[model samples]
Every structure is written in structure tokens, then in C-alpha cells.
Target: MAARITARRPSPERRRTARMTSSDWANPYGVRKPYGSNGANHGDGGEKGATLSADHPLVPWKQPDHVHQWVDVDHSREELDRFVRNWPDLGELLDANVGHGRVVIVSGPPGMGKTTLIHRCLYEVQQRVAATGPSAGDPLAVFVPTAGLENDGRRISVDPDGSFAPTRLINARIRSEITKKLLLHEFSESRVRAITAEEDPYQAYGEMSDLLVQRNALLFAVIPHIRWNDAHLRAAFLRTCLSHAHTRIVLFVEVSHGAAETAREVAAALSGSAAVTHLALRELNSEDIWRFSRSARAANGAPNGLVEPDRSSLMAAHDEWKPSDVRELRKVFHSAADALRRAPHPWPIDADALRPHWERRRAGRDALLRHPILPRSGG
Candidate 1:
């Protein structure tokens, strides 16, 4: 018994390195660094970056803060109800455009949630059309994000079939969107192929519109950042509108204070001097920011988001920072959430708590600017 107790001679298998579960391998005293599928390190959450579970308290910060990013309110109704600041104004504009061949201009300052607002409104319009239309299926809402269209004006893409495509940049984008939506809705697969094969964007658009009309379904042609000076582009858009006389055309224009007159001219021409509905978004106030941030978190499934005291602290911090727009404010929130997720910090974080993060970010940015690449050695 004494000899056996001295230590059972380890078996060959038992002598091997002990197997450890992932939890045992994880650092107990420090944050576990996550790696994405590409082997890139991600420290935003215990999981992949921006993929935190819905119940996570840091969920709100996961939202993309870019001005051009369109939030799909169809999938996030809670966020739509909470963050959409200009719903009443948008409702009136959409109400006027229903079943009418009219262009509505949605104007707002940069980063004022113009794109998000339009997305939510259009989603609502789609739902209404789906529920009340004579069609058996959902309506089609085609969005053409013509970013950098000014530089890529009328540029053509070489097709895979080794032919020069006649479709312009915006029109081609529309065709692609139509084909994608049709396939998603399980519409006629043959029709999807036909739309994809069509070389003329306008003709493809007309054909798609005709199909939708036959189903008595509504079609929304949403184009954003359309300037008034692009006569050729505007004429092309007009042709599409003319072909689909009953389609809802929405032109989302970002309005700078200095360019008010230019925006008005754009609204006039795009509307063809017809009665145009206008929905203008105002800048976010302090309360709006607070409420929006809270709702954003809640929308992401954080039912226990910032309490009243925490919200007050956040608002004070935001006021002191004086973020120029919602976009900047979002960046602040995202950074704060990221920091908290990395290390569990006390609740109701104030300016003092957030200053370190800002300083670190500034230092990192400065270091990058000072030396974007490693210094070269003498050859």
C-alpha cells in the first residue's frame, strides 16, 4: 500500500501532456484575444469584432458608424422605433408618394442619419405595399448607392462574357440590385436571369417594373446623393421614372448649409417640377443623442443598457467632447464600449473614465502619422 501510494507508475498515455479544454487554456487573469477566420486579431469582444451576442451590454456600440452605412430596419425594428428621429416628417413624405409618380428629396447634413432615415421609411413603405397591395408577394425596393458617381460618371464595366457593357454605373447598380432582390424573393428564376442578361439598364428596369406592375406591386427606386449638375445622369433617371410612371422615386441629398440653393435645384429637376415631397432632418441635440444611444443598445438586445445616471454621465461626456455630428458621437460610444468589454469597469463611466481612451487613441493616431511604415536602413 505504501509503495502504491508512492505513485502509480504512469501509463504511456497518462504520461503524455494533459489535455486542456478551451476554458482551461483561456487566460484567467487577462482578456482572451479573439482571432477572426482570416487569422486577424480582434479585441472588440470575446467573440469576433462587432458580432457580440444580442444580450451583450455592449451591443449598441457594434453598429456601424459610417455615414454611408445603411441600417436594415427591416431586421431591426426596435432600433427603427428608437433611433429614427424624423419619422413623422418621413411618414408625411412617404404618404404623398404612395401610388404616385413623384420624386421625394430627403435632405440632411452629413452624418445626420439621412441614409438611415430613408432606409427605415422605405422599409415601412415596402411593408405597407406588401400588406395592402393586390400582389401576392412583397414589393420591391431597389436602392442604388452611387458613391463616387461624380468621378465614375457614365463609366462602363467589361462583362465577364468579354463584351463591353453599355450599362452606366448607376444603372448597372440598379440592375444588380433588382436581380438580387428577385432571387431572394424566389420570384421567377428565369426572369432573374433575363434581367441579369439584359445589357440596357433602363430597359431592364422597365421590364422589371412591368413585371411588378402586373402583380400590382409597388416599386421603389431609391437613389442617393444625386446632384443637379449631372444632366446626363438625371436624364437617365428621368427615363426610368417615365417608364415606371407609378413607381416611388426617392432622391436622398446630403445638404450642406452653404449648398442649400444647389440642393433645391436638384430637388426641382429630379421631381420634374411635379409636386415633390421633402423630408429635412435636423441636427441631433444632446437629448436626442442620449436617447438614440440608449435605443441603439436596446435595439441590439441590451435590455439593461445605461441607467439614468450612466446616461447622464455619457451625455455630459459627449457635451464636453462636442462631437460635430451623430457619426462622431457613435465613434465615442463604440470606443467606450470596446474599452469596457476589454476590461470590466465600474458603471456610470464619466469623462474622467473616458479621457484615457481618447488620449490613447490620439497617441496611436499620432504615432501612425509620424511613421506610417518602418524606417529604412541605409542600403
Candidate 2:
């Protein structure tokens, strides 16, 4: 008989790591089709694997920087046009070698396209910078989502004095977030690992800043929703980022309109001493949504003979859902199109037809938006 061959099962931690490392798990947002593709996809939840039709008014929905497309900025769309026109000052700030620290607070209601706008602006700046020439000192914008920075769902080491406990924990989380971004930027993996391993997170962060400075690169970190309680931790991180004194770094803090206190705290941390820029995004009304939809339809151009939504049907769905923000509007239209596609005939589909489907998806979608990414602890 052959010697007994036993395959030791992977440790729980290893198994968890394997699961988290999967493409779908890493990017909760599923693989996006090439830009200008008729349909888009959200990750596996709510409307699991639901693909919008090419001719759907909201086919190419708003997305993060990784999947952003220049074509999404339709000049005919009032909101998109105004957002781009009013956004130049900050864009200039990011591209300029100002050699100082600054903070830009972009406040808006939930689902108002704050992240999408910021990503688009940064994407434009990147394009312009490339046209000028490639240099180490070029400004590099890094997006850092802060939802997971809070508690991180990991048991923390108790500290009686409470002096460094929160700082240590939050710093580690922040360091991890930045490390992932740097790796994506093609920074050395071994070097990144070594830097993250530094005992002091602030020191490690400073090393990150120095690395950018050495290459004459500026780091524009876009962190959304800095909780009121975590304001100080963010402030501390900002201080570390500005350590270079000569290396210009920008911190773009995004908060919902309801989080006034959080925004004030983060701004106060700057003490009115550092350069600060503020912009507010208002929720869209039905008219604005209608205008955006019409403009998008024209700009995106549907396939010939493809049943397109008329304003009446689109308005009917809008009235049914009564969407409160850009995000909700996108979902409403996308779901309406999905319903139309599933119909036995190409007859017009309205909100009533999508109501049951939308209702069933509401709870799951709300939960997902609340915690888009709950990063598991550990490497």
C-alpha cells in the first residue's frame, strides 16, 4: 500500500485571504465592459449580473476612476458641463507644482456623483499632464475610500492611556490602503512591502511621501467620508503627508451634505493655515434628470431600430421612483431598461412594471451602498 497521502487543509486565515484576493472580491464592482459599450455591470448583489441594454438612456452609468471614460462628460448635459467648467481651479491646483499642502472638501448628498466627478476631473488632469511630458515630478492622484478605515472590524489591542491606540490602528489601515494604490501605480512591490512593515505608520507614510517627492511627483489623495470621530486621525495623516515641506501634497476630502460636522472638523484641523478649497454639490431635480437623460441618449447614440425610451416613459418611471440623487436616478433608469428587455414584446415598459423588481432589490442595494467595502483584516 502506498504511504498515506494527506493534504492539509488551508488555515482559516489563509482561506479567508484567498477569498479576499479574488478579482470579484477585491473589486466589488464587477468587470466593466470597454468604454462606449452599451451596458454596464454592478458587482454580485441586488441585481446580480443584470446588464443594461445598449440603447438604454443610462447605459454607461457613473463609475470610479478605474473605469472612467472621457466620453461620459457630455458637453450638452447641464450638470456635467457645469461641473467641468466650475472645476478648473482645483484641477489647476493639482497639476501645479505649488510646493505646499492643501485640502479640498467636496460636499454633496449621497448618490450625487461626488466621487464620479472627482475621478473625472483627476482623469482629465492626468491626460493633460501626459500631453506635456512624462516626468517623475508629475502629479499623481490616488483615490482612497475610507469606509474600511473605521474599526476595520478587527479586535484592537487595548491601550489604557488611549494615547496611541486609535492612531496606531488607523495608521495601519491607512498604510495598507496607500500600499495597494502604490502597487497599482507600479511602484516596486518589495519596496512597498518594506515600507508598510515599518513599525511606525507615520514614519511609513512619510516614506511614501518621500518616495513621491524623490520622483518629483505630487500625491493627490482623494478620501471620501472622513467620519467626525476620525477627523483627528485624518488630520494626523495630513500632517505626516506634509512632512516634506517642499513636496506638494493635496488631500481631497469628500463628505455628504449631512456630515457638516465632519467636514468642519477636518477643515479645522488645517487651522485655516493650509490652502483649502470647498465645493458643494446639490441634489438633482426631475428636470435636471430629464435633461441629463436626453443629452446622454444623444451623446451615446443607440443602435438603429433599438427601442429607445421616450421622455413620457422615462418621466413616468422617474415619478414612480421619485429618485432623490444622481445614483438613485441611475438605478431607476437601469432597472427600467432591464424590465423592458425581459418583456415578451418590445412594447414600452414603465415604472409600474419595474416596481416589484425594484422593491425586491432596494434593501440589498441600500445595504451595499452603506458598506461597499469591508476589507478583512490582515495581508
Candidate 3:
């Protein structure tokens, strides 16, 4: 997943997320695309250009670090129920990880918010970890995807043009950034090592697994596809059992019709070694689509007046969203948020200011189903 996410998108933050991970978002997917792809800004939930269309957006949106955090409008209690209500409770996951490491397998279809759920839970754990910095004996947590680290061993590189670039992919950058933002601490180098072919991915993995056995580290493994790497994953799971540290492995496997068999095989591998729990992400209903999505709220509070979409209007628009188009929702929100930030227009944007892009988005909605890897259901 890290490799693919990095290659598909050009956003460095997204790429860094693929490399280092560790975002507290319960939605565990990396925002970056794989290397050499132009559409990476859409991966994860970061925004690059302020607009969604080739043309400039209505509200100029710009933010450093590609993070788009739209402040949702004051929602009605009944309408704004958390989309992530069903998974193993965040408190439970944290307690398990902090007390005795746990090996949990979370399975969900692509775009079913698997990444989001993981990220949400991760953020809680991160906050807890940060509140009380870890000592050598305490367990530290790292969020990583099954794709492993994609960057070469070096932390930064010198380009031919003389611009120095980060050697690690966007994943590394994200892990580093999240630590500073949430934990108020720099990401420690000792916590993550650049895996080289010389050292081998599994060798590095093994070393990390050994730490878990020692009770020094906790790993949140994001398995993009259950069917993709059964044998290798099984080996890693077995390693956790050897740890006297109460080490545990948490797995988030993306599901498809054909994935169940592979999941069972992995469960069999764990057998007596680790306790396992299975979780299926909830499919988004219309209500969730509204809550998890964006509105003109953030800009509304600005000195300049803005157009705020009424609930009826917002629900009507959300109704058009295809459930499988979950990833697209992120793109839309990021784009809109960024556009608002950078737009040259006066304070508080109105619907008229947003209609052009909204129209374009709606027109393109049907095309999202053809998106590679994540098509909107019935799109």
C-alpha cells in the first residue's frame, strides 16, 4: 500500500505518510499516491492545489503541508453521529495496546473508511503516549502500512538541480510531522530505520518485531489487501508471540469478495500464538456522508460573510455521492477547503462562489466509479 500510494501521487506529505505512517487517523490509508503519478495530492486527505478543476477554484485555498481540515458546520445531534461508531472502541484498543499488546485484524472493503478508523484510533493512542513520554521500559507505538518503507535509507537527498529532497517517501514525512504536531516532540530516528535491500525489509521488520517482544514498541500494521501477502504476514505475526513484552500486532486488511479465504489462513497462523479479533467497518449511510463531509463553516466565521449550505441542500448533495466514492469525498473536501483559503474573493463565500466547482464535481461524479482500485459502488 505504501509503495502504491507513493507511486500514484506527487504530494510529498502523502508520500511521507506512505513511508513513515504514524498518523493518529483511524482511517489508516496513506494520503500519498505511488511514485511517478500526477494525481497524488488526492491520496490520503491532503490538499495540494487549491482547486479541484484545472481552472482556478472559486475561493483560493492554500495551506502549508497539504493538510486540509475543514471545520464542519454545527450539525444536529441526530444527523452528526460519528461515522466510526462500530469498530472496536478506541478506548478498548488503546487500553489493550498500553496494557498488553494486542493483535487485532480489522477487515473492510476498499473506501469503507478502514484508513480513517485506524487514523482516529491512532490519534487517541498518540495523545496518550504524548501526555506521558515513554521511557525505555514503556511501549511506544508506530503506525505503518504493509507496503513497508519505500524510501532509500537516507533521510534526504540532493537533486541534480541542487534542491535537497527527502530520501524517505511521504510516509516518513507524515510520521515525523504527526509526532511534532500531536506529541510536541520530534520523531526519534531510533524508532524508524530506513530498510535497504542490503538489510532486507523483513530483516528490519524482524528487528522491530524483536522490540515488541522486548515490550519497547507497538506496531499498527495496515494491510491493504488480505489476499496480497499471507505468508509474509503470518511470519511477522508469529514473531510477536516470542516477545515477553506482551507485544501485540494489529492488522487492518482491506477486504474484497476474494479476501476472506486469505484472512482465515492468517487467523490459522496465529492460532495459539496471539488472540485475534475481527472488525468490519460500517458502510456509510446518507447521514454519515453528511457529517464526515465538509461545508462552508470554516469560512463562515471569517470576517467576510460566506454562503452556508442549508441542511436540506447539503443532504441533497450528499445523496448523490456513491458509497464507494469515499476517497473522492476527501478530495472534494480538501479541494474546497484549500480553495477557500487561497481564493482572492471577499470574506465568507456564498454558494454562487462555489457553484462552478460543485457543478464540475457533480458532473464528474459518475466517472469516479472508473477510478482505478476504488470505484464508487454502482457509480
TM per prediction: 0.52, 0.57, 0.43
lDDT leaderboard ranking = 2, 1, 3
Q: Clashes per prediction? A: 0, 2, 59
The local lDDT score (0 to 100) that residue 66 gets in candidate 3 is 20
**Regions more than 4 Å wrong, model 3:** 1-101, 130-136, 146-211, 226-248, 256-274, 293-305, 320-323, 333-379
Across residues 1-379, which tens digit of lDDT does each residue of candidate 1 receive? Answer: 1111111232445323322332322211121112333111333223322242211111111222211123321223333444344332223323423544444455544444455555555555545554544443444454443332121212322334423333254456655654676666666788878877888755675566556555444345445443323344444554454443443334333322222434454345455444345555555555654564444441221223222224555556555554444444444555655454344322333454455655455444422211111112210
Candidate 3 contains a number of clashing pairs equal to 59
Evaluated at residue 244, the lDDT of candidate 1 is: 39
lDDT of 2 at 180: 84
Candidate that scores best on lDDT = 2
User: Model 2 over residues 177-273: C-alpha lDDT tens digits?
Assistant: 7678878887778878988899965466557666765555556565655332344555664555344232445565565544344445544555555
Q: List the residue pairs that clash in candidate 2.
A: 136-215, 137-216
Q: Could you tell me how far off, in angstroms, the CA of residue 296 lies in candidate 3 after the best superposition?
A: 8.8
What is the alpha-carbon lDDT for the whole of candidate 2?
0.46
The alpha-carbon lDDT assigned to residue 231 of candidate 2 equals 43
Candidate 3 per-residue C-alpha lDDT over 110-145 given as tens digits, one digit per residue, 9 for 90 to 100: 444444444444454455555544432455665654
Order the candidate numbers by TM-score, best to worst: 2, 1, 3
